[model samples]
Target: MNAIPGARPPDPKDLVRVRDRLTFLFVERCTVNRESNAISIADGHGIAHVPAAALSVLLLGPGVRITHSAVSVLSESGSTIVWVGENGVRYYAHGSPPSRSSRLLEAQARAVSDPSLRLAVARSMYLMRFSGEDVSKLSLQQLRGREGARIRRLYRQHSQRTGVPWDGREYDPDNFEGGSLVNQALSAANSAVYGVIHAVIVALGCSPGLGFVHNGNYRSFVYDIADLYKADLTIPIAFDIAAGPLTEAVGSAARKKVRDSVREFRLLERCVADIKGLLSIAGPVDIDDEELIVDDLRLWDDREGTVAAGVSYEESAEL
Candidate 1:
């Protein structure tokens, strides 16, 4: 039998350092001294030096280096680097595209349909949203309450568990006027998780716009999958790492810390196992096989439309 998949692997230390290098650029304007092969990012005329050894640079945009060598190294080492650009996020690898398949999509769909699996996803979202607490102890039924009631109860429970002050006021997106430290950190974490979930959904071959929960007009499935991961998996772990003494302002350092933590965390493996268990898949599903599952879902659609499971993929592929 094939061995059970291990935890999500760690990012290379070099990649982490390279990410740190780019982050320095974001917080300050920098000048690259090609003669010295070093980069200096200056803040208010004070310069911070970045060593060339820390990066494998490639020119992508004007005045911007893509860090091609670093990206290649990270991808080769089984890490995913999503570049968010003007056209939206694009996935890249050191060599070839990563494996994604349809059976995994079927498994995820089944997992979402299972009560226990749904609760696990919900609990993960809750814990991630409110760390330093035991939000996982709450039941799925309790979580399904009205938003105001759910938020109020969660605040009180979190406060009681962690002794952290939680004002019951609703979360206001506008409150970050001059950049509240807490708000900024939380927002960054949320965006990071959102990106990860989007990638997962794409890999799974399910239309991210269709979801079993957290319904919206657009990409509801993305929200649903992300919500499942929030409590028990991504958020709490991010908060735990971010709340530590080493945590800093919501800059590249903080973002890297959170991203690295998520990468090292075994959320994906656990998610895969839970999904497989729910779907009763006996073995690991190759991601490249996902188109078949999409075809299956389409067959279901066609049946509902005209009452028939018409031509199979084999027949279609032959044609």
Candidate 2:
């Protein structure tokens, strides 16, 4: 261990689990470098040190200068590094998934490829959203209609609770400022949850493009997963923030509220559980999450589950 510099690389178990990490850290007009195992940020604001391992998403905004060492440490820590545009929230790039195992990812692919199974997965997602509501008898179209109604109701409820005016959801991605105040807050809040969900989705090695409910985009699965929590996580926060006094700080304020709500609801932990449950991965209800991330090396044999990965079976083949 002494041969290693700036403290030893952390054991996998010692590193914080993806579900428990702090939501995000935004850095703009700052320089980022690795100091020991932490990331050092220097800017006109001052200097600060943040534990790289504790970060979920590190948003590098405008006027940011980052060192290679800093990127390396953040990647090693399983923290997502997002490069944004001049406005500070546009997404560009991110870090790789942390999972070494493909168990769940394979399950996802198999489920998504089959039409019936994919519908089944989508139905399961609906159940998660509605909880006690019975959706097994409904087709995807019916479910979609129901979901739309549910969201509209949520918008109304939040609007009344926060006393914020409810206009229909409308916004152009290219023109954030053109939207109304409530719309802007909703967009910002949704983006925050979407970013966190994107990190979780990729960290699990599941295909972001392989969505059961929503499809076509690269982050289809991210959109699908994010929708599950939007009613609880972002919708209310957005309305609450919008109802407050208008200021230039509204976007950041909405994101901050969403971050707090994420922790309060333990959204990350629920998200991981919901995904595993939806995919119908074979396991106990209380299976330890740590066990799922371990790489279970095996050679595929259609009928059999595990074959020795290192063995040569050429001579034993029927051919």
Q: What TM-score goes with each of the models?
A: 0.45, 0.89
* Per-residue lDDT value at 230 in model 2: 88
User: Scored by Cα lDDT, where does model 1 land?
Assistant: 0.42
Give the number of the best model, judged by TM-score. 2
Question: lDDT of model 2 at residue 92?
Answer: 81
**Shift of residue 275 alpha carbon in model 2, Å:** 0.9
Q: Which residue window of length 10 is worst by lDDT in model 1?
A: 85-94
Q: What lDDT tens digits, residue by residue, belong to model 2 across residues 19-75?
A: 788877767799999998899999988889999988888888789999989988887
Clashes of 1: 19
Q: In model 1, what lDDT does residue 34 have?
A: 31
Runs of candidate 2 with Cα error greater than 4 angstroms are 1-9, 86-89, 281-288, 292-298, 301-318
